[model samples]
Target chain A: MRRVIKNLISALVALMFVNAAHAAGELHIFNWGDYTNPDLIAKFEQMYDVKVTITDYDSNETALSKVRPGGHGFDIAVPTSSHIPIWIEEGLLMQTNPNEMPNFVHVAEQWRNPDWEPGRNYSVPWTWGSTGISVNTAMYGGEINTSELFFSPPDELHGRINIVPEMNDVMNMAIMYEGGQPCTTDKEVLMRVRDTVMAAKENWKSIDYGTKEKLVSGDVAVSMNWNGYSKRAREENPDIAFGYPKQGYPLWMDNVAVLADAKNVENAKLFQNFLMDPENAAMISAFAQYANGIAGSEAYMPADLASAPEIAIPAELQSAGVFVPPCPPEAQQLYTAIWTEVQK
Target chain B: MAETENTSSVLAAQSHQVAIEASRRNKIRNFRLLSMPALIVLTIGAAGPLLIMLVYSFLKAAPYGGVVWEPSIDGWFGVFLKKDIFDGTISIATAHLSILWRSVNLSIQSTLLALILGFPTAYFIATRSVQTRNLWLFLITIPFWTNLLIRTFAIMQVIRDQGIINNFLIGWGLIESPIEMLYTDFAIMLGMTYVYLPLMVLPLYASIEKLDFRLVEAAYDLYATRLRVLWRIIIPLVRPGIVAGSILVFVPSLGAYVTPRVLGGGKHLMLGNLIELQFGQGRNWPLGAALSIFLLCVVMGALLIYVRVAQRGTTEHV
Candidate 1:
């Protein structure tokens, strides 16, 4: 009986060690809904011989809140640039060691050290896009520069425009159109954006997020939208025209960041490296129609897209684009207050 | 004779005792079984989140992401301060209150419309044979099986400029450009009426089914006119059904999000939409919680008003 008991105890200890070894291969990714190509996860799973679980959030704010609550059972997350600084400040993000990502060298030099994450220590640039007005050129006489199509369209088409419900996009567009700096922590700029938005509230047909399909279906004439959506819109109907105001276009980047308390750090790092591969980055960019940070992704892009004026970032237009940083609590509150009032 | 009387009495008493004990045991067993799942569902689904929201609403908004645990009434107070009507503060613009008011208005309007449209049809079905009634009820329910989101989108397609109605009109040369029918108040009304119509019909049908048609016949025999019969006798008979159906349609309509969001084209930001925003983009859980609490109050207030009116009417009849 003593011999049998001793054997059983030793066997149980051995089994527990085996279970710990088996747990390292699993990874959980939480990202924006419909943001990733379906084949990417399958490919990652095949490459690493690990299981991947994916979840989705509609906004950066939603993701942040979920992560702040000890995380929503996710190992990897893709947050927009605006929330990266805040996530870092809150100690929610883990600074990934560059040595772990062998493919990190393939990212574009310009996108490598964005202002949002100074050292590119915390985030991997997944896709970059400019927020602009995507319109049906045939319906609207000509290409328009000002964001006024959203706020102050033709009286006949007053309620026929769709604007993004996102705070920063709407607020920044308002300020930028008024010839003010985009995303100022200054109180005067915020108040001006608020007043401008409030004045045009009645003209807005809809304030939508994640409703790009509605735009493509001709539900709204002109929609304040992202570049990827505009690309798809034009692909579906060739007449769709995307315009970035000469004033400036609010540029955004979605970056993959491993969580601070991620259970599968090794697997997360592996997945991040997998995403950084030029071929894989090209696949995601083509499928998602968003610009990738990969140095060679442009060569793999479709011919029309490769030569597309909007996709081709010119030096002159580069200065017109601005990156929004994670805002302070007071600034967020002020924006929310203005938005709620405008809607009312 | 004495033996026969004793035996009969004993058997009757024993049978009664056995039945009572069997029922008692069955009741306890069923209660124990049912209470476990009921408690679990309530704890997980409703009570737990409600308790959390109650806690979070009093706490400060997280500087970066969530709410701080330290309790403060700032969120609730934020719901009350009157600011420039355009400010997002719950207190200043009072959007939550406005949403609540609009929800009540739309709910009442749609409920009344459903009652009007559903009552006659339900009464017709109820007066028919059971086979016919079931067939009609089944027909009424066929639409509900489809996804509500699909139905809403379909409604949009039917009313949009490139939709069938507009295409037919333009083809016939009835008008010029396709009239904007998609994102108007009319579209919202039509969507609400469609979504809640079946709800109105089912309850009204059940109520009218149990109503005695003889009562109306008897009134007619006593020389009461058809209008008088319907107004005084028929309606009174199905009062409970009306109450039940009204509650069913009104409650859901008041909290409706998708239909208004889609059909109304975000123009009609209802209570549900506002609550969704607060919990979502607005990232103001305290305000969201307060709004939720305010909606709950409105619902309770409505129920109270309905019960009072119903009670008063009942007393008058008595």
Candidate 2:
């Protein structure tokens, strides 16, 4: 009986080793749901002679939770730019050698050394866009160029508008609409924003994600949405239009990083290099309906996308565009409190 | 010969007693063995996370996301008090309290609405023949086949400004303009009623089907009007079903997230959404856990009172 038990244990250990060996040739990725272009993933798989397994998360919080304790064996993950610092502080990401990634030079200058990852050792920019308003031109019969149209609409537009459910975007828009700084930590200013949001709540159709479908279907005449989603919606319904709020919009970036416990770090680096190639980046941009951060990718972009106002940030809005930074703990709590009040 | 016979009989009786004791012990052991798997699963799956949440509720929320090991009651205090971000001073706030109150109020409203809408359908189904009753019940359950999100989305399609309802109303010249129907309190209540109506109907059907029709007939014959017969006889007979259905609908609606979130459009905050927000975007797990515990206690207390009242009712009836 003892001999049989010892043999069983040995056999199980051998099977585990075999399983590990089989997985070595595969790269696992966790990314934002519907954020990646599957064709690019297939192309990468073909070029690398390795299988690529991808998982998607809808929210940065969900992705962070999954990756916090060593990334659940994912080789690479796409987290919002704001979360890179937290990921590093939690030891969830692996440091990358710049020398291994020659394509790093293709990234735009501003995106190279993001404030979150100071030396740019961990993450590379994936896609970037701004949070702004998407309007059905036929319904609104004009351009929506300001947050005022959403927060304090005319009587006709009341109950015909929705805002994104993300706290940062909503609160920032409120702050900008009130002519205050987007990242203001002052209580008085925040309280004012809170009041504005609460007052506007009565006029809102809903505070929800995925406003693209609602806009296309004309369920809502106006919505606060990402530029990419607005662009995607426009393809289905040509009446849909996206505008940069004159009051400024929250600019956001999604970054790709290797996990600390990545089993296929080499493959992950290779994939990142492949994604950074201008043509590949343009392909991703075209597919995702979001602009990539690759500097020379515009030459490869399709004609319609290259000149599309929604995909390209106008020069005037550039100075007004602010990156959403992670707030301090107390400020975060305050934001949540105000958000809860608005929802209530 | 008599003494020998007595000794053999006594020995046989003692042997029989030993046999019974051994079998009883074996049966108990078998029962325990059979229950082991379930006990293990319950401990690991259900009780484990609950214990972790309880522990985390007392800990301080880490600045970034998760909780720190430091013990604190700040989460519990913060539920009803607003903490000043700058000075760290706290004051009584009605925001959270109002949210809780709103949740309770909406849940009660939805529960009553569901009950009103479900009773007639359940009764109609119960009065049907056995073959047809099953067909009706199956029809009632057809909604369950679709995902709740999809069903809610479909409901949105029918109720939106450019939706079928508005189009039909406009085409018929009944209304010149589209009435704002989606994302209102009415829409939330309607959605809740639509989702939980089946929960109410199933139990009511079960109870009404088992009811003795003779008592109802007797009450009717004794000069009891139809309304009086329903109020006194049918209602009393189905009291258990009413209580069961109310509990089933009310408790879930109290903590409902999706219906209110999707239909109410995040304007109508409920306890479940608050809890979810804490763990999701709010990044305040301690507060979320504390709120969860508070909600659980309230539910358990209400259930306890309900059980006691039910027991009293049963005893009085007996």
Candidate 3:
């Protein structure tokens, strides 16, 4: 028995060393859940001989909290446009050297030189989309043109409507519905928007962060969702429609950044560059259904998904939508305070 | 001179014995030092995360994605400044409170129901052969081996539209349309009750099994009615079990997120969900931490009040 136990202990020690060695080449990526297919990671492993470890955060704030402790565990993370400046100013992200990444040239023109990350310094754009209403017309018996479906849903639709759990989306929707610019940091405008949302909260059933599953489950009639998730949800149940309200939608982007203390720096950079490649980017976009930042990837996308009028990029409509910039701490504080108070 | 030498030798031996006793006490102290790892694990696993959250609440969100180290009242102001919004019908404060109240109310109701159902069942088993009692106890523990989320999701699928219950209703031509059974408050309450019922039963069963039946029979022989005998003899003995069961049911349900998310639909938002939104899409850590502290304060305050009330009630009967 003693000899057997000694053998078992040696085997366990050997196994631990094997796992530690195997984990060395692996890059741990933290991003939105279900944002990419597992097959993409397998394909990347086959091509690059680098293992990929993927973990997902349901929201930007959740991802930020995990990466805040000086990049202890995660090598690559996807954060929103609003968080880029904050992450850069804190030195949490490693500066992206354009020379090192040749595939950076394929990024969409609109993503380059954005006010948030000037000169393409710290982050690389992965995917971009808009926040709009995803409604089941069959349930509503008509079309939804405004954010009212979420803000002031009909009595029958009460408890059936799903709103974004975020204050930015909620407050922005209120501002847009009230004929105010969605991105305005004007105090009076913000207060009015807050009050409007507060009034709407009484009848608000549930605030949902992830939508595709909820919309398909028939728990919600109308939901505020990203264009990609809405499209995905509609594919599962054909009766759903994703539409931007008559008021402009909130345009947001997820950017991939290498952490300052990344263990697998080479693998992390390689992964970012790999994602930038048009063919690989197309495979991701086609499966994820979210629009990618790679310029030439559109050519590689399927004709049905690419040319579909709903998913097509209209230059005029794109310009009208607001790109979220990192606001002052005061504005964020005010937004947070109002959101909590409203929920209370 | 002889007496002095004898006295000194005896004193020396006595002092040596005291030294030996002190050494034994020191060894016990060393044992305590070895057990310190458990306390460190508890502090790191629970209090450490909460303390980090508290610290982050005071900091400002930097223009880039990270938080600025500068201390500010901005986070507190953010939560407090929305008083008008909180006062409004759609306010999160009201919603959070209502959800919490509903969860507490449901948990309490279910606990009472479990006590009623489990007491006699446990008593009968306890009175039976020891082998039968062991089998019954084992059956009660079988469900706990599975994950909570999977079990809750299973319950959801059973009652959901196109689920077994809905299909049965539709097949029987009981209704033209699938009943909106998933998102309503009723479904949330039902799920909470089901999840917590077994928890209440186990504790109650333990208490009921230890009960002395002779005391109840003596009370009945004294011409006490069934209700009076139950209240005076049986209930008083099982009071501790009831309190233990209630705490078990109440604490877990207080912060429950999964059941409401899956079974409650979007209709019923709980305090857990509100706190989640604050950290999640809300991007408001200070407010989320504040809400969490608020919940902790409420739980602590209620516990104090309950202990006092329960003591008084028990003392008065005595």
Candidate 4:
């Protein structure tokens, strides 16, 4: 009986060790809805022997508001470029310093040290895309590569245009249309911005987020659309094509960062480094049809995708894209009022 | 001896009746005692969120979509008035009024539409035999089993340009081009009518089923024509049902966000969507809270009016 008891104790201890080995850790990721690539998650989970769970938020405000007060139990989050400074100022994110990670060299030269995250202290680029106009070639074949397609649609496309419900994108484009920089505080520019959009609203059929479905189904012949969604829509309907708006467009990037109070700090840091790898970053781009800032990720992407017009902006038009960062509280209030009046 | 026994039995019967009445009173007291927890839960559950909303509405707006601790009436002011962005002149918030008007307009329109459509349906069901009546009701409730979002999407599928209706029209060469019907005010109204039709029908059926049709025959015997009998007899009898159905359809329509969002094309703002904007991209939580409370007040006002009319209708029934 004594010998049997000894054996049972040893077996129990062995079982506990096995459980510990199997249970590496768990990571809870809060990201934009329908944005995360499942393959990348699966690969990361297998690589680190950790469980990965993702929750989604539809907008930057939602992401910020939820994470602001803490206790969200999220290890990582992907927030848009415009809201990054706000998140940093709120101290909701931990400085993971991706520049110190092994995979930091894979980040493209231009994106290696952005003004928002100098030396990549806090975040890594998850995906980047531009908001531009997408037109159905069969509808009106005229100059589709311009903001005029959205703000001053031709007679043929009148009442057939759809503007996406992104307030910043619409307001920024309108600002640019009046020969002003984005997030400009000048009252005159802001006034023209309001007037331009308000007048444009008449020609537009809808201001909606589901422009991809609307475009593919031919519900709207023209739409102010995001590049990735336009790419997906074009895949469904070849006649639907995306064009970089010449009168400036919004260049936005969603960055992955660790939460300040994350329990799995090591795992979160590992995931941040994992996203910088070319193959993994390429997986993200493939799923969302967005462009990743990883150097040589294109080698892993499909030939059509690597050279897709929606992915590759032309030379002259490349300079037209601007990253519209967060406006100050006062400027934001002004913009909000203008937005309300426009939609109202 | 027989006289004595009969008197004793009568006294015993009267005592037994008294005992039964006493026990019934005791049971009522026990029921009230047992219901305390549920009453407490209801009061807390329903009123707690409302209290929070009331408090939030009076607070100052935070920069990035929350309220500051400081109290201010800016939210309420924003609801009825606007400080112009350009000239900095304060004026009546016609934009807000327009949204409010849209919500009210849509609710009223949908209620009437639901009545016209549901009245006939409920009547048809009520006129059927007992076996068929339940089957027809079962059919009316079949739509409810599916989720509301799914139903709205199904409507979208049926009406989109490349969807079944357009496809069918084009296939048969009925018209040269497909009609754009998916993203109009008509579409919003149609979706609402489809969604809340059952709410209208059920109440109308409950009252119509209890309707005394003998009055109709009596009216006819008094030389009342078909239209006159319908106006004087059937309509008057179903007044309670009409009010109930209208309230049921109208209240939800006023708070409707999904149907209008899906079908209204975002060209116009409804009250529910406007409130949502304040909480979301508009980044003004105080405004959202104020808007929510305002909606609650509207709903309460509606309910109070309904209660008064319903009381009168019930009294008239007796």
Candidate 5:
């Protein structure tokens, strides 16, 4: 009886060792919440015979704070274009080897050499969307297309508008509304933008991040939201509509990059290549309700999404879309200060 | 013979003293041994992070994020001043100071409101029969079982424009349009009061339950009015609970982040929200750490004053 018990204990210990070795082959992914398709993750795991672990963040700042500290154990992260430069400057990101990622050819030409990372050395374009107005036309009784309504709404719409909580996006929209450059660091121009925003603050219902749900529920008549979120909102409520401000709006792009201290660097690269495949990229765009940057991915996307102008910005209106650039440290500080004041 | 007796008595007294001292030392050693685990956990968990935050508050902010190891007082200056990078000039700013004042004002308002609502409820529960008191106490804690975020969101659903309250009012011809109730300061206070009311109630309940009912009856029998009896008898006995409950509610309310962010519409920026922004989008960790330390000092100062007052009160009573 004692020999039997000893053999059982040894077998259990040996099994645990094998499991530990298998767990060592896992991949860790950090991205926006509900941003990727689980089916794609499952397929990738099956294809590579590796286990995948996923974590989600709500904002780019949260992701940056996690990855900025070396050895956060995240093998891959998805950060916005503006944050990519900071990641590179801080040595938090690893340079991509295009030779190993042959599927890079399928990326759109515009994203091939983004101005932020000129040669696409450290980041791969994942998704792109515009920041614009999502209006409940049934509540507003008409299409609310211009930035003027947001900054200075009519009596009926007063105290019925919600703005994004993000400072850069809202400030950029205010600048565009005033016909100034979005990235202008001139104090005089920024002060004018600040005054405009302060004036608009009176009419705002709330400055919150959950604009999509607010619009759908009619808690807010108008909201500044990302294109994809607005698209999803419209699906839930037909009265909800997305409009690109005639005055121009900010364009946001998120990119996937391998962390510098990634334990599973090879697996991270492999997952990136797998995501670049046209069908898989289409699946992501369909699930996320956002446009993927892969060149041929639209061919595999659902017809409704492929035809939806909000999901894919119309070629003509694309000219009005401006890619937000990283601000200088001083300007960033000033923006934060102004945001604090506006909140007050 | 007298000298020898005196010497032996002195010697015996000295040995007895030594034996007592040894036992006292042994008692202290055992006490420390019993508390060692808690002390170590507190040091590692609380004191260690607080020390790190103190160090970071004195350092410079790295451009991308986090802190630089170099010593600098710029973060401290930035808290109360704005620097123009163009000409290297600094100007005094009252914006951050006003936010701090606002947070304290809101915290005090909420704490007082919680006390007003909680005392009566706690007193009523304490006066009930044991079985009923248990049921009422259980009901009071039911809200706590749900996550705070979900509860705040639920509050939004009730107070929003198309929410139940507005709809009911409109349907009953009480109003023509929805009353703006969700994003105002009123809503924030309501949320804070709702969240922290239980904190106030529990302490008050514990104090009220232990009160000598005979004293109240005797005061009433002496021709004291009901209100006078409460004022003279109940209030004096429950002073400690009031102090405890106020501190419990006030401290957390001062550092409230989500309630204000969700219900206040992020319009009224609290100290907690400002500190959070400094770390998140502002990418100014040094400033965030400095603000945090400032808040900590205020709380610690309040706690110390309370402790001293409490000790003095006890000594006077003795």
Candidate 6:
């Protein structure tokens, strides 16, 4: 027994020495739940000999609030495009200047100088998708390319529809449907936004996440959903289809950046540069079923993702997809009040 | 010689008094040292977060999410009032009021229903033989072995549109369409009642097990009906248990977040969800903090009322 204990302690010390020799460092990533591609992380870990830890946040606000106070110990964070400016303005994110990175040239020209990150200094695209209407054609065979299907649903659609409970996404669509812009501070538009959603809530059965499961389970015939989730749902139930709201829809993109107070700044920089590579970017898209901004990454993506209507935007509806920026404090307050009333 | 002897005796007496005082002080010091960790845990670990919440409720909300150090009453005002965006008319926050009403209403309903369902089960178990009573109690706690969230999901599986109850009813040709249970008020109430039923049972069992059957039999011998005996004798004896069980069920039900989210289908906001909304997507930390403090006050108020009523009941019974 004594010999066994002695051998065990010796073996543990030897293992620690081996680990000390090979290990480079550790990288902590805070991203959306189930959004990180495991394969990409595994590959990065093998190449760099660094351990990576991933944490999840359900919404941009959650991530922001958690990271804003500092001492979070997260090396990297993924913030949506709308929230990127807030993170930057708050000095929560480091200006890593990914535009100067070696693989940055592969970033698509359209995404190269996004409004959120001019010159792409601080962040790189993680995933980009649109929020639009999804419907099971077998339930309602009407034109689904309009927000009217939700805001003023027909008799057949009433009590059979689900609404995604995201405040910004829902409010942006409602405001746009009432002929307002994203983050508009016009009082009249804001009031209409309130009334529109309140009336629509009467028709909506639930406001929730887990759209794909609800859509596949025949729980809701129609829902306002993310395009990637709608695509996944369509695969399960062929009757289900994605509809780009011609009235207005949100084009959302999540971007990855290093924290200003990151302990492992070098490792974080390496991870960010790694994400810009075509193969790595493609892996991210393939896992999350979303699009990446790397131009050559599509060639590496699955053929189905490349050809699907959900992935590719038609020319006519292209003008309708609008990017919602983070609202100012006053407008956000107004929107929150309206949303709370609607839910109540 | 007498003077010397008196001095020695005096010194001995003073020293002995000093030793007694020193020993007493040592004992108190040891007690403080031994209990230092618990005191720190209670004050800092438990009350520290609550103190932070109380402070945050008075601060200004940052542009995005965090709080600013500047103190303001706007957060408290936002809890009960809303200003119109265009008209500038200040009105009662009907939305907050209604959500508050729904939470209380559902909690009351669940408590009442649990009492109705649990009293008999507890009585049946309490009356069983000692071995069987132990077995019954073990079975009563079986649901607790699983997670609260899992138990809620289990209830959802039983009542969903395509779930067991609906399918069973339809298969028997008793219904043409599945009765819409999920996402309705009924679904939330059912979830709360079922999830908290065990809490109700355990307390009632603890009280009923100690109940003497002689009084009940004596009441019956005097020509009292079964209902009268139960009401006049059994209920009074177990008043503390009922109060305890109701508090255990009602408090958690009022703050219920998961059951409503899972079974209630997230159609509406409960008090808990509304507070979460202000913190999360609403991006109003002060408001969320204010709401949470408000909820804590409401629960404290309810507990105080229960304590008073229970005290009154005990006094009246005596």
Q: TM-scores for all candidates?
A: 0.88, 0.90, 0.82, 0.91, 0.92, 0.93
The residue-by-residue lDDT of candidate 6 on B18-50, one tens digit each, is 999999999999999999999999999879999
By lDDT, rank the candidates, best first: 6, 4, 5, 2, 1, 3
Query: Worst lDDT window (10 residues) for model 5 chain A?
Result: A309-318
Better of 1 and 6 by lDDT: 6
Alpha-carbon runs more than 4 Å astray in model 1: A1-24, A154-157, A185-188, A209-215, B1-40, B83-93
| Residue B275 Cα positional deviation in candidate 4, in Å, after optimal superposition | 0.7
> Which residue pairs overlap in candidate 5's backbone?
none
Give lDDT tens digits, candidate 6, residues A1-344.
99999999999999999778867789999999988889999999999999899999888888887888788999999999999999899899898999999999999999999988899999988989999999998888999889998899999899899988888898999888999999898998888878788888889888888788888888889999999888888889998889998889999899999999999999999999999999999999999999999989988998899778888988899999998888899888988888888878
lDDT of each: 0.80, 0.84, 0.73, 0.89, 0.86, 0.91
Model 3 alpha-carbon drift over 4 Å, by segment: A1-24, A152-159, A191-205, A314-316, B1-37, B43-128, B158-181, B184-186, B261-269, B281-284, B316-318
True C-alpha contacts between chains kept, each model in order: 0.46, 0.77, 0.30, 0.70, 0.68, 0.82
Model 1: DockQ score: 0.29
Instruction: Summarize candidate 1's per-residue lDDT along B180-273 as a digit string, tens digits.
Output: 8776666776788888899999999999999998888999999999899998898888888899889888988888888888877776578888
Runs with alpha carbons beyond 4 Å of true place in candidate 2: A1-24, A141-143, B1-32, B84-89, B310-318
**Candidate 1 backbone collisions, by pair:** A337-B88, A341-B86, A341-B87, B81-B91, B83-B92
- Candidate 4 colliding pairs: none
User: What DockQ class does candidate 5 belong to?
Assistant: medium
Distance from true location, Cα of A32 in model 2, Å: 0.8
lDDT per residue, candidate 2, B1-318, as tens digits?
999899999989989989999999999999999999999999999889889888889999988778999999878887778776546677775778888887777778888998999899999999999999999999999999999888887887788788889999999999999987877778877787788889999999999999999999898789999999888788778888988998998888878888888877777677888998898889998999989888888787877897688668766655
Q: Give per-residue CA lDDT, model 4, range A94-209, as digits (tens).
A: 98888899999999999987776667789999999899998988877888889998888778888889988788788888888889998898999988888888888899888887
lDDT of 5: 0.86
In terms of TM-score, which candidate is stronger, 1 or 5? 5
lDDT of 4 by residue, B190-225 (tens): 899999999999999999999998988899899999
Per-residue lDDT, model 4, residue A12, is 99
Q: In model 4, where do residues sit more than 4 Å from their true spots?
A: A1-22, B1-28, B167-175, B306-318
In model 3, how large is the Cα lDDT of residue B306? 72
- Using DockQ as the measure, name the better of candidate 1 and candidate 6: 6
**Each model's DockQ score:** 0.29, 0.51, 0.29, 0.52, 0.59, 0.73
